[model samples]
Target: MTAIAIDHDKPDLTGDTETQNDIFLQVFNSGDGALFDRLYRDDAISNFSGEPLTGEARRKFFVEFIGAKPVLEARVTHSYVAGDVALIGVDFSVKGTGPDGQPFTIEGKCTDVLRRVEDGRWLMAVDRPVAAGGLLPE
Candidate 1:
């Protein structure tokens, strides 16, 4: 597993930034539906690789992606929160053999927006990836 190096100076906006990041890492490394239930709102929306996702669609996307290529590692390069919105920038890589028997790896950066609900629970509102050397897809 590759070690993800997080910048020590990154602001922990909500005082629970580390906790939230850890939860996200765990959820990605393990295809745990319960984690999804905790981290994403019912109306959560995500854009990845040109696809728009929401609700169950978003949940399934995470589940399937994690299931297929168990995250080898992830690092939060930057993170910030203002008011009820949190933006996290992460660098991650997944290592695994594809169904075609070819080894595949994807290294990319993701900017995830988390919103604090009325109940004070944080849930992902937008999760988008901007691949290195490629245009940001919507």
Candidate 2:
């Protein structure tokens, strides 16, 4: 288990997972789903619970998600690398307005998997957020 302390005042968007996490926060808060083009791979999958989402389904989800424009704060608990694939655990909290314009907040952990591409860049491959536990896949 590794602990990461993120300084909200000065977030450095230079590294791998850290940069993406910040991007995640930014896109959500700003309701800019277009930014997803840079943060995720074309075949990327995201799971809130159960099986991951991909393809057109994923795109539609992002549209709905961005419309909510949730504010988020995520902290990395642990990260592991193996060749091109990396598994990262993040603890996160989110607050936002609902369809009714009521503010709400939720806190939990997420497991995000990233892969290093041939271009020497890292992109999210799988994202499982707000799960009950920060458990990594076997």
Please, what are the lDDT tens digits per residue for candidate 1 over residues 1-138?
Answer: 343443223312233666666766755666654355446667877775347678777767766666664554667888898988888888876666766788876678778888888766677888787666552543
| C-alpha TM-score for every candidate | 0.73, 0.74
lDDT of 2 by residue, 33-92 (tens): 545534567798877424577877776777676666777788889888888888889888
Q: Which ten residues in a row have the lowest lDDT in candidate 2?
A: 5-14
lDDT of each: 0.65, 0.67
Candidate 1: clashing pairs of residues: none
Q: Which stretches of candidate 1 lie over 4 Å from their true place?
A: 1-15, 133-138
